[model samples]
Target: MGNLIFLSGQAAIDQIGGVVGPGDIDAQIDQAMANIERALNAVGSGVDRIFKITVYLTDMNNFESVIKMRERYFDKPWPADTTVGVSALALPELMVELDVIATRP
Candidate 1:
């Protein structure tokens, strides 16, 4: 079996791992995607290999925003995805978190 890289839900965290963008879901999503990219790259994989992702959001209202951001990373034949709304997260500042599953190169 190939390496399966499972990334815990990532929030809008900065280089120091501090929650960023606060109430800005767009910014948070951006950071979360970037974090996901870093994690995938570290393991010799990339977004192209991402087979699935589960997104957690403080509010379901940001669903479209997440989809828009996904376009930035994924193209045709996008990965399987699931988005859920939650009342809270590990931090109040985090508006979005992404659960990533990718196959290693």
Candidate 2:
């Protein structure tokens, strides 16, 4: 049976709990996506196996930049997703958070 893995939301915070990309949406998105990648690898899955994802953004205005930055993480056959803009996250400085669901072979 294929294994399904659900990764918890990853914000721009590092493993040490330090906020990343304080004022830059691009940097925050990158760090969040990178954190997801690391989480996936830890569980024997990867970005290509990602079937669905939910992205949370602090500002809707950063949509374009988030999509552009997302290209660096996901390729052409991108995963299905839903994105929502929220007023705040767990931390005041957190800007982007990614929720990943993937299958593990």
Candidate 3:
């Protein structure tokens, strides 16, 4: 807790408790990233300070989409990352989930 922040897995569920995108992978990825940003911002940190990230996906075929979307969030020397393909997530409708470790500001 000194300088690191461990965030729980963030899914596509929005601020209102509804999935942001039911069957859209790209939209889901965006929402999950937004959620991650929100969590980090709440503590005075932002995505630029993330040191590591773990991604979960219900379908490995969507990995390419994740890669493309990731470029929008992180730049060169990106955070350490690990992506896993799971059979399902907390909600069946969810397609992607992201969790990250970042430094506190």
Error of 2 at 36 (Å): 0.8
TM-score of each: 0.93, 0.91, 0.95
Least well predicted 10-residue stretch by lDDT in candidate 1: 69-78
* lDDT tens readout by residue for model 2, 1-105: 359988877889888989898999988887887888888899888888888888898899989976785587778777888899999999999888888889998
Better of 1 and 3 by TM-score: 3
Question: What does the lDDT come to for candidate 3?
Answer: 0.90
Which runs of model 1 end up more than 4 angstroms from their true locations?
Answer: none
Q: Which parts of model 2 are misplaced by more than 4 Å?
A: none
Ranked by TM-score, the better of candidates 1 and 2 is 1
Q: Which pairs of residues clash in candidate 3, taking residues 3 or more apart in a chain or in different chains?
A: none
**lDDT of candidate 1 over 1-73, digit per residue (tens):** 5689899968898999788898888888888988888988888998789989899988998899978877987
Error of 2 at 9 (Å): 1.8
- TM-score order of candidates, best first? 3, 1, 2
Specify the poorest-scoring 10-residue window by lDDT in model 3: 65-74
Q: Candidate 3, residue 10: CA error in Å?
A: 0.1
Question: Mind sharing the TM-score for model 1?
Answer: 0.93
